[model samples]
Target: MSCEKVLALLNDWLDDELDASQRGQVRGHLDNCVSCAQSERSLRNVKLLVQAKADRGEPSDGLRNRVVDRLTHERAQGPTSLRWTRSPWLRAAAVLLVLASGFVIYSVVISGKLPSIAHATVAEESLARHIGTGVEGPVEPRWPFETIEDAQRVLERELGTATKLPIRSEQLKFKGASPTTYGSARGVRLFCEYKGRPFSIFALESIPDEVRQRSQCCFCRRKDDRYLVACWAARDLYFSMVGTDLTEGEFMAQLMAR
Candidate 1:
């Protein structure tokens, strides 16, 4: 199978969802193709990491109990009988319950006002976008050091110590590409390799009001490549990064460290 086909099937293959014949074919191709071999290895590592995390534990029992109780209450109050639904009190109670459920979902999913599984999922997705889209294209050598301490020293010299944000490389697992410009208005954008992966980082003094209003950004990649991007505002600085050649989880881990 072609590389593209293999890539599309990669997630399923990793999950062991592929049929026996397909799995054998993919394994055979991987044995002969260096690029496919590397991709498979990376995906396997990511699966292992995710499985390890899941094995640690689920959400607290208290949270699970609350969710179960709410569902049970909803079922009990649900249309008891055809005539019961016509009663005004029952109708009002049903409306109130719907509103309450909506509020709970919004709090957990949208506003992130609650500590729940949904909140954690959203945060992880945000981090993945930030780290994955920040960098694109060929991997670049890290600022010339094997250790975080050395990276910190180099970053201090280049960016200075005026900001509170700490610069540490212990978390940087990959680096990619020499810095490049995204567009004139956005200024110089460079692709950095961290934790053995690529991310795009931008140094913008001030984000345009229009960009902030829309909360939308654009990213480009080679025709067949996939990328994830995330952006944030830090004081007067605005930064966005894209990830390529890395799993979403791996990219998020690197970004959260920042």
Candidate 2:
């Protein structure tokens, strides 16, 4: 089996979803491929760690009583009314533990301390290159769209207003369309500055298909730093911008406003 096919099947194999023959093929490939074996081991370890942490605490008496009471109430109504009772506290705790574990794993992976599995190595290299030169060098040239008419004209010439919403310059301080890079890929982006701060928006034409699939729509801040980035998609367009000046909430507000 090919590496990609094996990698895809590994999850199903771990879940015991495969029949004997398919499982044998996967096992054979894994036995010969050190890289795939390491990946499988790492994934299994991470899952086990997260599960162990999530299962650390038992539900309290109060929670147990609530569950029993809810179940009893349902039973009194009819067997057809029966449903599983959920513990909100347990759910919240599980979510917190998973996030914490994921953060630790991400930190380890980003710091280049992880094992040299092929996929992990490629991810590390890609992140490094993106951080090193993605947003560095010359700043994108700002188009002079000072007046309302000028803004409309620039948008018309460069992007054309057909795709963009009408200008709301009255609500902003510095309003114009500018080009910037999104993530690690080279692309043209749009910007609309609010007050003295800038909120960048990306044109749909510029972003690559791969990046849009992986990242979330909300803003992300670099660890131990003030840099904030907000990303969103509108119709065919995708946008992400970074600035250290605004809080995450403020950045998200600006993005929603646009």
Candidate 3:
């Protein structure tokens, strides 16, 4: 398929709304066309960005309060007295102010100021830390437990819930666990290594519906061909694993077995 045709079908292809033959054709094109492949990756990233924004829900309380205060002041002054209502430049400035507020909230989310499973920020932070590309900050690595029971003790202490670790081959060595908080919910992130490649497993008490609806049991996707993120919902908790060695299908099988 030509690049133009591929562009036309990109949305459906990503949404899995295409028929089998159409999907095959698009896949075939993506495999052979470097430009189209890059376009698809860009589109995928856009989708993830939008999902992150939606999963973040609303703006911060401080932002909302500022907006509310502005509105209240405007109400007291009345619309006729409000400069923004009469001056185009002032109206434009008001719009810019709102945009600036949104940018500030986004900056906080990306900076790891808010750690929550409902938002993508925490996941990105965890993955970055695992890969050693995390921003300069205090290292909170906790692990090398002598027994699974020991890890469970820490998990319970941090998350207020006890979760069983999935059985895995000895080739994968357990490193440690880290306490993670997302809003009012709490969870634990477990780190491991497979042949020197780092991997992470985390369990969150509340899973966003957008994530849960995407997969009945488990879902997996690759990020820039560098790593894999596999997630599943089990026993009132949401579980996710990140690494490159394990495929989504393989991860799902193990999760199902558990």
Candidate 4:
């Protein structure tokens, strides 16, 4: 895909509306293009800021009180000081700063980074690993592993619970499994092939509750049209599934259906 096409699809990509194949094209393009990469970074930063602002939900009483108190104090100051601080332009600037500070605090407290970026970072990593593996190679899982059972044992040793493999259908073929690290957390990834398409499922213990709570069912994002990321929290584990052929809703239904 050209830079223009990638740029045009960025917003849909961020919102998880794009299909998996398109996502892969964007990811592939961004890999070798420095200019597009920079544009992507800038666009992502703006998205993170916007998501942080919305995730804040509502103003906190303490933050509101502080802003109000500052305004009231400035109002009560003598005329000389008022002349310095009471200009309309200065008040607008002050309000903007306060709001900006509130978002900064929200980012720090909620996820220690912008929640969207942090989650997207992990998703991007998953997509990279999956894409790099390609579609037709012999499934070789790392860490001396061969089976999902082995992966479960290793994951249990690290995370204290066996991975809950979500596929129940007889047609889903297990390809391989491996352990992985996302941010500061350790987890396991299971690879499978269904209907000739390969995908990966990841389980991590590091996602913040704030980030997990953003979606009740699944939080999906697109790295490229062919790459889809679907994430959710369960018990003490945060789970993500990345696939080139899967839709967020389909992945969720497969994993979550009883």
Q: Which candidate is the best by lDDT?
A: 4
**What tens digits encode model 1's per-residue C-alpha lDDT throughout 140-162?**
32322333344334443433333
Best of the two (2, 3) by lDDT = 3
* 1 versus 3: better lDDT goes to: 3
Model 4 residue runs over 4 Å out of place are: 1-147, 150-168, 208-213, 245-258
Comparing 1 and 3 on TM-score, the stronger one: 3
Where is model 3 more than 4 Å wrong at Cα?
A: 1-169, 182-184, 212-214, 244-258
What is the number of backbone collisions in each predicted candidate, taken in the order shown? 30, 1, 2, 15
List per-prediction Cα lDDT, in the order shown.
0.46, 0.46, 0.50, 0.51
TM-score of each: 0.28, 0.31, 0.31, 0.33
35-128: candidate 4 lDDT, tens digit per residue: 9888888888999888777765677769987886556544433263243242321232233233333444564688676423232223344434
TM-score attained by model 1: 0.28
**Per-residue lDDT of model 2, residues 123-168, tens digit only:** 2233223422445334344321123344344433333223233333
* Candidate 3 structure, TM-score to reference: 0.31
TM-score winner between candidates 1 and 2: 2
Worst 10 residues of 2 by lDDT: 81-90
Q: What's the distance in Å from true for residue 54, model 1?
A: 31
User: What tens-digit string does per-residue lDDT give for candidate 3 at 1-258?
Assistant: 788999899999999999999999999999999999999999999998898777666677699878875565444334432422332212222332233334435656777564232322224434334333312223243322334455444433332212222332444566766655434334555676644657665554445443433332322244544555544442234455566565533433333333
Worst 10 contiguous positions by lDDT, candidate 3: 159-168
> What C-alpha lDDT does candidate 1 achieve relative to the native structure?
0.46
